[model samples]
Target: MRDSIRLRTRARLAYTACRRTRCSRGSLRELSAVAVLITALSSACENPLAPELCGAVADQVVPAGGAVSVRVCFNDENGDGVSLASRTSDGTVATVTVRGRVVTVTGVRGGTATVTVTARDPGGLSATVSFGVIVPGIVRLTDRHGLMPAWSPDGTRIAFLGRVPETGDTGDGSIFVMNADGSGVKRLTKSISAVAPPAWSPDGTRIVFTTRDFEIYVVNADGSGEANLTNNADWDVYPAWSPDGTRIAFVSDRDDDIEIYVMNADGSGTTNLSNSHGRDDWPAWSPDGSRITFTSRRGDDIDIYVMNADGSGVTNLTNNPALDLWPAWSPDGGRIAFRSGIPFSADIQVINADGSGATNVTNNPEYVYGSVPRWSPDGTRIAFTSADRNNTEIHVVNADGSGEATLTSTAGTVFGDHAWSPDGRTIAFSSNHSSSGFHVYVVDVSFFGKAAKRATR
Candidate 1:
């Protein structure tokens, strides 16, 4: 029965130099490096010398109770068959059991485990192969449309935009919050049309978001004490909290042009930070809260810029002719990561905070940046979406752009708005990968580059 079970790895196969007479990169949209999936009805390669364990096992991202099975067998040119035995290195994350040559692995929790399978012939000769299974520190928090997830300062709750059931594909929703474990979901705001991403206050008591009709609102985390901060007729959106929690930075067209603006925690002391005629948006606060980084088209080209908290000492960091967008500061406040080449995310590049050295980390044109580059909590790695073949996937890379690993290579698209857990062990993002509406999901980053390699890698 084991000999008849065919070996399949994920949605597509990418084989390197091992026994491969041909190796080409997998197509962007259809490839996933998630697991060494099992199929039926094919024989593995024959081994004339001894019982050779055939096929390979790769890493997997399964939910807490999910299960994946792999077929194990030995190629015995000699007619003697073999018996199979399988064991898990860590039973806490996953459990393995073998029945007739099929090894079924069940995920226990949010962790990782390695499974090793041994095939022994009657002569006492045996062969063994092992594969790693990552019961991903991952969870799909929302079953419906939930976008722009923001972690509360205390990391206990996540604030996001929940789509109104009646509105489809309009990118509008009411603000909501849920516990970090995805339970205790509660609605906070009632903005039914075109609600921008929500931002949490530093003290974790309140949230801020913008509406499609050009207004900004702040409300308590429990859905009380709602106030219109920017009760204006002009546009106001893209609000960001300062590191010190004293101020909020946002973009407004009240000046008759789009520019960066800042306001106090309350609805007072509104200040215009970037008073440029060119478009300036996507403000980000440095780790120390001393400066702000944003992207602008001030010089007839889109580039990243940094300025003091008070809107002084403005300097252009990228200065490139290409459209540079989404400037993200490292956790240590030493460097910045942004997308260069095209708005569709051509490449992810990093530059020193002082605007001295700029380097391209992901130079491949195929790995289109899905959104802004997000830095890990330790500032050691960056996560972004890749449209390798126009399939939106979440990927992680070393700060230096090394050790790139494909985390979610689903057949569907992984939308943006990814947020890291405060402890940095998990990342929450939005995706339509499960053949459902866009929902919020989280993946434990424990699988970062350490997971099993895919034959299609």
Candidate 2:
């Protein structure tokens, strides 16, 4: 009986030890009740942090010393707030700062980096996501057929001819305006048959363009107040605004032949400036508004001609037997840049304002043709379209005929009609790089080292 009593005591000690260690429950009902209590506490906690981010994250490209903000959202599953943190994989390329859930990344140098964002809960649970950032040498502004990109006088917007997606008809194009970086694209005209790219007024308030019906129209920058400037049935095209915004020079065939004409800003006082027998067209104005330059087929071959604003003192700038067309005046009005030779096999030539000392700025043997040379605002470099046997690309050359470089090298692409921003920091052009016909694109000119080469002649 004493041994049995000792055994019972030892059993009691063992039962106490099992209860302390949570290894045994007295009954099945007790065990189930304890489990229910633990599950209730866990349900109350409810995993306060969510696994997925709530906001949109996009890969970004910024210039050196530029900054962009990225926002992310994290939902708290248990109705409690959370905190977010961010880190950059390469701080030398960019630096990140987190204020609440928004991460601001500033480009520090030229490279690429990855940014990771973490969302954390009070219970020490967290989740992470990452995105890429690139400091690119070139940034493509548009992905559609954007032709003839003309920058606004203020340099904040660009105007171009956008080819509408063809439904069933062949000719559906309109004028469009967008930011310099290819954002905020707004259609400035409805479905109209635009024949040329729109030209902005000196005041940046209005745009002038020619339609396929050979009519000159002026529309407000906001796509309002569209009025036909030349309502005549004749072909009135190639509208250019005078530097002072007081007059518009255009090409018209009203007198049975194409000639240069100038009118008041309100489309009044229309007078023939280049009333000649040969077809005179493609008028460009001097920056000082003292003269007008145009392409004419008056002599044995087509050439560039300059005349006074009032149509007197007509002088041939390029007396070349080969074709010389599309005379673009330099920003300082010191030189004229034009294209020589036939289509697809032309070279860019620059001449003095007084029709002397002409030089071939792009003497490239591989480039069969160069079209429409546009001088940068600083007049140091000229941008034009060069075509080889393979494809056409945009090219830049020093005004003195040195340091010629192909700015674009896309295969099977054709690029043309480039315009420079007022500050000469960027160039806007049209390209078919995506095989979708023509779309406008803008590239950072700063990436092309030393764009400022003075005219040698």
Candidate 3:
């Protein structure tokens, strides 16, 4: 009934208007009468057009501490004055300022921000164009295939290995020290071969790195007081300092088989901890300095083993048939994260410190063999590389294989070991994003995409 009444009312109004206009011969005659009525009803004091806004704005990507500029405008035919301004919805990611028709956005930190450019006219008409300004969370810090990034204990400086001057692209790299912000990169030693992850002393005053000549060398943070810890080395690599800074555990093949060796901080009193018959490498000390975990191949399948600090009480941790390598101890010394499975299809798994309760954290089996598991300083999350197709990405997940998040998605990109900052805010690693040269890179963990999440407790 309501529908029929509304239809009848509309028909009656149309017929009345058509008759009142006195020219209802055709549909065009009635339409002309209605046009006249519209002109009469419109406000005579207003202009016909509001404002024509500029076309869509493009998304802007800027590095942290960098700035970019974009232009926007409005077209108003009313002869009214036009004014423009820009604002950012998230100042922590980016901030914007407007000058005339231009809008300049500066990246404050990693993440994404929404920038809105608004234009207004004197007739109370406004037009706006909104776009995103993104600051990449994973930023390339160094160039030319920089590898082996290690943060100083103080977190104000970073020690890494990268191509040095005069070496060009032909040489491997050398030890380097730089400010935490990627500035003040100074070469600390000569060129090296068979590079390993450098270790910084607990006191933040010394750095231990491997050289090309199969020797372990220690130098002051300022590139002085260089000393060969293993003068007659037979492939000594993976130098890691103990928790108390009294001894350094490293991998050496001096004996018939590769074994883990510990030496005093001053390059004296070297002792072999792993007297295994098979390969042994990647030594990591527990937090309390009472135990060391390493990759060993004493049995048919490679596994992880933990031994007392004084080279006693060796126990197998991962009893898997596949190869398990790159053992990294959690900060609290309660768990260890390592890479498991065979090549081309490996997963990162975490096992309890006492060699029980093993859980696979990265179930994806596409990661390359180099995805070493690194635990955050808080020991709540594990960061590793995940490869899909041919591209590898950095990803983080909880210890129990939950809350997985991708930190990087660069195509055809390979990565190195991950080093967590002491404060657990950023992760340092190596990437070849520049195409020509691999360099050191840092990724902000707390901020992933367009927003920042509170740290996982």
Candidate 4:
């Protein structure tokens, strides 16, 4: 009923606005007639999109230490009710408050803050309108194909890989790093051999990555001190750091097949954890630095396996024929996420640490191939790389596999694995965004609309 009334009102207003009139402004009598006609027409029809009146903080500006007054605009569109409610995208609302069309912000650090406004209907039962607040200098990192983004623990920077063709590089490979706001874009590593799968250490200090040879190499975040951790010339790759910053678990073919191995932080003490005769790879450590879980081909199928820290007591967890690989543990050490399938027909799957009930959380058939699953620090969502029939993009889904959405587009080819920041607000992945070189890219994962503000600066 409300929608009908709103639509009729809009139609009548549009008709009056477009009707021939000597004077541009309509008189009170004409307005009243239009309103009456709209009300009558609405009462006689069924519709949706009830006109709603809402207000939101549209502007926010803060400097390093000063407070900024926020501006809230009164949205009279479709005029339904006036109950106003607002929230910060990060759920921290002390920076701004809303009442009617006015909003005041206090105690904001010089940068950008986002506050959202929503209006409830007269009945106070449903939200009628919504909008956003934006400021400048707050940079955000995003990509057409960013996934598995790993942030340096210091929170000052991010490193991922991407490809940008307009920059004259192939959409197929590159490695890059930039400030948290998407500035200071320094391409750290470049190669025509197809570089992908980058991971950072727990100390926010060093980075380990993989190239076409499946060998892992460590490089200083500043693009110096590059060293190949797996210099054996075997197919060894997918390096993940231990929680204590003392070891890196990666895959290697030194055993005549792909297997998970651990080494000292400095590329020493290399030992195979999944000593099974079959292939095993993708080792991720538990949060406490105790056990490691990975995928193995020992059970005549690709499945998840867990073992102790010292490459002992290897145990198969998944026990299925679905071909599960790329197992990532939740930050809390409760569950694990992995990718499974027939090459391009893979999806993100999750299971408990004990392997008591595996579920394919991302059950979407649309994701013909989904790989490289990483969980946010808060354990609320999982981000992974996915490809459809037309293009490849980084996608996120809730822990329960609901609310699946794409973060990147067909702007370029998005290949390789990605790492998620420990803070869970950004992703670093490799894409051909610039095309000049395969550089790592960062995308803001902040719910507060922080990326746009950073870009304008």
Top TM-score: which candidate number? Answer: 1
Q: Stretches of candidate 1 above 4 Å error?
A: 1-137, 164-172, 191-194, 447-457
Measured against the true structure, the TM-scores of the candidates, in listed sequence, are 0.70, 0.67, 0.69, 0.61
Model 3 residue 58 lDDT? 63
lDDT of 3 by residue, 17-49 (tens): 777777448865666566554443342233346
C-alpha RMSD between model 3 and the true structure: 10.7
C-alpha local distance difference test of each model: 0.78, 0.79, 0.78, 0.65
Tell me which residue pairs clash in candidate 2: 144-439, 145-438, 145-439, 146-439, 146-440, 345-368, 346-369
Runs of candidate 4 exceeding 4 Å displacement:
1-149, 161-176, 185-194, 211-215, 433-442, 448-457
After superposition, the stretches of candidate 3 with alpha carbons farther than 4 Å from their true spots are: 1-110, 113-136, 143-145, 167-172, 191-194, 448-457
Instruction: Write candidate 4's Cα lDDT for 276-363 as tens digits.
Output: 7788877789999999988778746888889999877777787866778878888789999888776767778888889887787777
If ranked by TM-score, best first, what sequence of candidates would result?
1, 3, 2, 4
lDDT of 4 at 446: 63
Q: Which lDDT tens digits does candidate 2 get at residues 245-330?
A: 99999999899988999999889999999999999988999999999999999857898999999999999888878888899999
lDDT (Cα) of model 2: 0.79
Clashes of each: 6, 7, 4, 44
